[model samples]
Target: MGLWLSCVALSSADVRISVTNGAAACPCLGPAKHTPYTTMRRMTTRSTSGRPRIAVVGTGGTIAGAGNAADGAPSAAYTSAVTGADALIAGVPALARLADVQAEQLLQIDSADFTDAQLLLLARRVVALCVRDDVDGVVITHGTDTMEESAYFLHLTAHSAKPIVLTGAMRPGTALAADGPANLLHAVAVAAHPSSVGRGALVVMNEEVHSARDVAKVHAMRLDAFASPHGPLGLVVEGVPRWYRAVTRPHTTTSEFDIAAIDALPLVGVVTSHGNMRREIYDAWVAAGARAIVHAGFGGGTVPEYLKPVLAELCAAGVPIVRCSRVGAGPVIRNASFDDDAAGSVAADDQNPPRARLLAALALTRSQGVGEMQRIFNRY
Candidate 1:
């Protein structure tokens, strides 16, 4: 009888970080899967009047979870947990009096599902919103998965002077202990702070702030999984943000990819490098009609010698090839090892794959030549 009781007690142990609420199991999101976010409904929270009009854009993630109790044990606490955009706002008490917020469901997608079209669409929404006299800033609810990519996309495209901050959750809001609420609330506080302006798009996660271009999902499963490859740009504590570094790339309220100026861009491909390779993929892209290819090369942008000829052929064919390193820790510089005689393509040495792809496509759309695109990438 004693053994039976002990076993039962041991089965119900506190997992995850025990918070004021309760404990969720180790995987926090139990058999986590990629499911679209729930639909947007009229979620009511206390609102403030005479505050700067701020737009709350909901893109989707664990922040909008909907799970049932039957899926777990008896003491599994709440059977079903549901969180809305309004709930994200309410979680942080600091935002209620600071801004008049309006929630808009831009898209209900896991950040992993984000695509080029979605990036453009979100940028367009931001561009339209920032010009309004009543609108002071923009806040986004995103999945930590690919939050950085989307954030960087907005940073390069939106060109806004107002604060544009993206927030995400490592654990679902339904979990006994979730990080979504705090992260969302902090993002709102960051957005509403006048001092937050002019920093370009920012990612506020786990109390650490990062410039979008530098941040990446470094850990697979931790509340504090995200990290900026170049270290944090700043941090947030007690509802206030403090900065220490500057944004190095061209961004925010100043960029060549203006919202109204761009319409259609050429098709650009990013090929990641690894040991022992083939030119088949490059040839395939060229055969299938790729206008340009961003080579995510190995270690400071070095490509296999066997593939160099194919790259040269692509360049000779008038298709641009932009060299960017796959390692992503540093820039990809132009030289002989990465490119033979700098013949066929331009270098994306200083930019990540996403940024490189953006620059390549934009360059192709504008100048329509490899040399011109190279100059544009360098200038930007």
Candidate 2:
């Protein structure tokens, strides 16, 4: 688990671990043998006891799932969110060596059932905890289904530089080789690490660290399910976090959005485009009180020729539209395949449909202008 520091060449933008008073320091691997950047940054211990104080906020998922199998065997059929946060921490006793951990049960429900109100509550709770003097960082245990969306929302809304990490498991906690304990431990370790500060909200799964804005769930049942299209920011090996890169996008303290100011998230609906698409579906969303619409377009966010006028009509009626790609990877370039300018629509940039809808909802809470919304999508 030790990094080959002897072969690494240091550089200006490079980061190094500085373990003080025999305390463990967050470590990372350098690019080459002696990486060369003129400036160097060191991560040091914060607490007097040399252990960072970490808060574990739990929103139950498969990590807390329990199975009803005879003879205590793992089974596919199980009940989700059957356990609490304290139990999860107790299951991973090794976390005590990493940080002074505390657990709080925020919610017990499936990620698929997570509502906008619940997301708001969680974000507010996390931001509130981040400002406390006793807490150094926070780790969230969430369901894999909508973890990325929730994490991204926090990334844009959290006002602190303190580390906020989200983690979950692909298998139920009652399974034979449940991943919850290890994932929770790594999440705590990453949250406690000083190097994780200022990185914005992160998702730690399969022992890998990913920026909240980029990571997505690609597989349904595999242990290694979460992945980032822009690639993972770093990795956690044997409870040690090794970072490879940093997020360039505006996030956390740099974000303009604030959790305190947001009273309620506006309704932003998503409509995925497909062959022989129907206009009624799009119309229904708008009629159902959707303030903004995110069209999950096909290939470069292209709109069907027939539905163009319908969308253009809606845009003219004062509703903003966002063109986002339905594909798994790549950016949805503005005015590439679709005439976003003429239709008064904004491109989702690199964000997927659901994420685009989230950003759109958040952006609408502040402004509804096409240009400003487009800029928000671009910058964030």
Candidate 3:
């Protein structure tokens, strides 16, 4: 009898058990072994000191948006950035089980209206949070339209290895089958995970995790809107994150770009090269004081035959021009057929035009040399 009771205790301890809402009881241990289940319940309801401290910063995107319909039908016409960060956090009760979560509202606007000033402020705030000893990780709720841009911006400037994850939703919070709560919960899980350290900035959406540099909002209205042209880093399954690969490029603490020293970024514009494009558009940008231009060239970053001379003139006048592809995916090889090596022009390598413009602006802040700019593109 003694041997049998000892075996029962050992076997019950070894078996994984989950008791939800005090409804399910362990069959082996009875009332005497209920202490472990009670402990687990306490752990889930409140975070202990051992839990990772995660700060959730909300910038007001579709995830927090609400609709006006009395029936609570999801509507894209609703105002964005309407919900506060605390409410967003409260909406996801599962997140409380993963980390010690706190939230703060940063801004509330449609991402299409996001400006450079707002980007700068957001980066500074992220840097501040990452440096704190009390905070283990940070997550930003953002609009998907420009989420990639903001993520990449933080990837380049944030000087910490602590995880920074960005997430958003296509439908409003009031919509049926809203993805915001799930995305937010997964983002918090990723941010609190130990493996996420040194991964630079990340985008978590629709169960997939992507590096900031490669992730983009490819679809307009689908739940699976974000994807990386290269491939995602990993995915979240059953509230646990699994990473498949690591980012190779220099980022965070390894990056030379620092947000602390930069008060204002230089003006950079993207111009699409098309059939029969005129020179006045190029000249007008220069006249408006654009320090650099990212030419979204056709098919492998080729400048239109007509605009080549104008671009060369702009380069000679100390306005750096970067050649990037409008083809969406693929690298823009340097010294291509249309490249003017003598004019100090540089290629954007694999970066898209919008990202190229951001890099050009940051590179210009450090140096205007063509070689230095090219090196920045290659390294970052």
Candidate 4:
């Protein structure tokens, strides 16, 4: 059961590869076109017997970054997402031994630069790959800056039981002890593992596997920056993944979100409520075409007493308001002492401000009612 690559040139610049039973088609991994079938040029490699077929889609981040000559050893000041998917795959030779690996370069940019349209496109690509009979799992190489948000977006919309693992490095690949190769290897391992199926989208880094909904990048430069406050679902040690618990949240195939039919997401914004927070910030977002807003409030989603009236007024004006916490870990309770449910506001259980914004945007695409928005938050 060895992997084999069969290439067919659709055009002079485009090549389509069919990797026997090991890995499926290797088309262009560049920016997605109007249709999902457009092909691009990339190399493909085969694998050993009885290996799972894994596809690695590269959307650059620190894992693909490169340092300048002025930077010291293990360079910290490198440009992100400059490296290609081919180089990343070649850097981790061990990946070839585990599964039939296929590589594609989708985008080359910092994760922080990820736009809503790109997120939607990525979700569409992941869903397309998962539905294919040959692709057993999908591994996304992303920047650590906004990996959690992207992972969560895919988690809610992917609609697949096949493993979708996201991984990235805090350090550049050119660094003395680059973490990219190892993280990519672990991601592939998790993607190929049978246990990873039906686990929804996962973030694999520093040997830890976290559910997308719970994982966050808490540290700026540390290699172990990503963690789940509720603890990780499992870990990978020496290329073997061990489970500690199963994710109980409704996600993936169980989620009501469907990205396939959505071409564009509704406008949503996030405003942080702080000490002496001005009401103008909220006004600006609404003026800027925000259909919904996630107020990243103080502890447990509390807003200043002065801002309450304005929030209620916005709700009356038909913009849905979602309450979320800036403090990072606690659940924002609906109709809690400070939360006014009657004013067309909803609470985001444990989702942070960015994630809450995504949910709000997605929810708005389906319904505008506060109760329905709240139900969407509670279910997802």
Candidate 5:
């Protein structure tokens, strides 16, 4: 179990420290049951009071879980995907004040269990919703585990200029001080705001609005989990989105990739570097039908001297190799630690391993040459 919280406070007389530990297991674990209210339905977009019609699509995560039997206490013991989209929307009535919100139950599985088929289905559904004449924006409720990957995938594929916001909680909704309601409210607020247009997909969590390309989950168990190395594009202050910066990279309407035309994503493998690594692992991944590989290398995307020949051989054999740093932040500059041109490998810039895999998979659909692949990485 991980340390849940540690807080320090200072007063006139003394200093006080408090500590909390997360639950080892969910006490309320049981078979999942469907509630009658959890069904998907569409509502009229424009009402008597015209508001930006926002669609709230739910794909289960910790935000919709009910782990503890207790009513008002924080506990990590819970089953995920227990709650439904309608219930989540009903819990946050303030969402209606921000926009004409409607709930659509897309899936009720943990995001770690989320499959490539489900991802393609969700992307198609989101694109369908965004193009509708009634809908103005879309908000996705997802698991924090893989939220950044999904956000970046949508950022690359979805061509709509309307806002797409993704948000989730670190704690279950039934827990004390559950973060789902507030995060959802902020997500809807950012989606409805006109300022969010043309910013591509956004991840709204812990009151910060991050562009999908830059945001990554930095902490495993913290309310402020998601962060951008370039700093957040803005913050949500009391239901209003305040802007500070903008995304310069190509995304959404500016991007060349299209979700509707992509029926499947190519298989891309990621391997991390460690002490005394062997070349057989790379061979196994390639044999398993990986079209490309992302090497999550040591600092500065350095490869072990012994393993370099194998990577070079793979690149020469027509499989594209991408060199990316395993570190949390920083770019994998081309030809910095190794001669990328000589090895016929591409650099991942500042993108992390998982993101590099997604981009590599998408890039293969258009072209497979190392030069074009590197250009795609550089431009996107």
Candidate 6:
């Protein structure tokens, strides 16, 4: 009996050792990476070691880029970003003092590859973290590529009291005097500061804070790559926030659409009208699977007459359509230019094509039927 007991104890010890080694090898079992950005939550550490435990969720973008070749170009940058959250934070020690930081990798792909479903997933995860008590706020280190889309999605959907901020470096970390550390350190400072709350999902860059909805990539290859055509919400100077105009929309922990009872996303399509436009492009997409089509019409939502017959057919077939202007700014009028608002067609006045597309898709996804879809767009 004593020999049998010793064998059992030995077996247990060996099992534990194996488990420990396995845990150490895999990332999920170790010190949580990218906590603030992911859907999953982690244990509160006693470390008190870093900033205030602000989770840095890593969604792969240029932010996670590493030079493909060694000694290739110090100006051409590279990082062993096997992980984005911890790796970025590790590079910026200034983050260590601004907030208790935990890294989490949500989506580690280039932001350009992101789709509607991915945006939904990221929004869901950010909302999940905001509802938790242990987490103070969240910061997303995203690729500047599609950062605006994700930011706007979060701004429109997620409900949160904590500050949700997205930041990235224009130049790679391998570049001389890389800009990432400074941007990240400032992002952490803004994420931890109290004034950042109540504002919608914000993009912090070049020490400037811009609303996700109003901000866009104005410069092609500059450190100040993003610009809000209307202007910035505020500025972050040496780790402190100062706001000018008060954000008035129902956002941050107070949005019905943020946590509304909606699950499956509606089938939406984007159809751009070009010179000598043919109907086949629109017809093929409708035949494929598009429930609603956002017609990227010319100025003021006007479409070529050649395609009008097809659009009329589309309306007859019961596919809901919204006329969104391809123009970067301005509202899409309901019937002012299309000459068909009197019918089933709708307009997305003043909203750019992308934002209009998102609104149209989301609106259709919510309503029970086509009539409801039109009503959703009109109501909004």
Off by over 4 Å in 1: 1-50, 68-84, 90-94
Residue range 186-279, candidate 4, lDDT tens digits: 9988887655778889999999999998999999988889888889988885565667877888899998888987788888989987677888
RMSD of 5: 13.3
Name the candidate, 2 or 4, with the larger TM-score value: 2
Each candidate structure's TM-score, on Cα atoms with residue i matched to residue i, is: 0.80, 0.89, 0.87, 0.86, 0.87, 0.78
Instruction: Give Cα-based local distance difference scores for all models.
Output: 0.70, 0.83, 0.81, 0.82, 0.83, 0.68
Model 2 residue 228 distance off true place after TM-score fit, in angstroms: 0.6
Whole-model alpha-carbon lDDT for candidate 5: 0.83
Residue-wise lDDT of candidate 3 within 45-78, one digit each (tens)? Answer: 1134456788999998999898876765557667
Between prediction 1 and prediction 2, the one with superior TM-score is 2
Tell how far residue 95 is off in model 4, in angstroms: 0.8
Please write out the lDDT profile of model 5 over residues 1-380, one tens digit for every residue: 22221112233322222222343422222111221111111222444455678899999999988875655444677888889989999998766666788899999989898777888888899999999978878999999999999999999999998889999999998787889999998998788765577889999999999999999999988999999998999888646566788889999998989998898988899999888898888889899999899999998899888988889999999888899999968999999888899999999999999899999999999998899999999998
Show the colliding residue pairs in model 5: 26-77, 67-78
**Alpha-carbon runs more than 4 Å astray in model 5:** 1-46, 71-74
How many pairs of residues collide in model 3? Answer: 0
lDDT of 2: 0.83
> How many pairs of residues collide in each model?
3, 12, 0, 1, 2, 21
Candidate 3 local Cα displacement, residue 120, angstroms: 1.1
User: Which parts of model 4 are misplaced by more than 4 Å?
Assistant: 1-48, 69-74
Give the lowest summed-lDDT range of ten residues in model 3.
1-10
Question: Considering lDDT, which of the candidate structures 2 and 6 is the better prediction for this target?
Answer: 2
Off by over 4 Å in 2: 1-48, 71-74
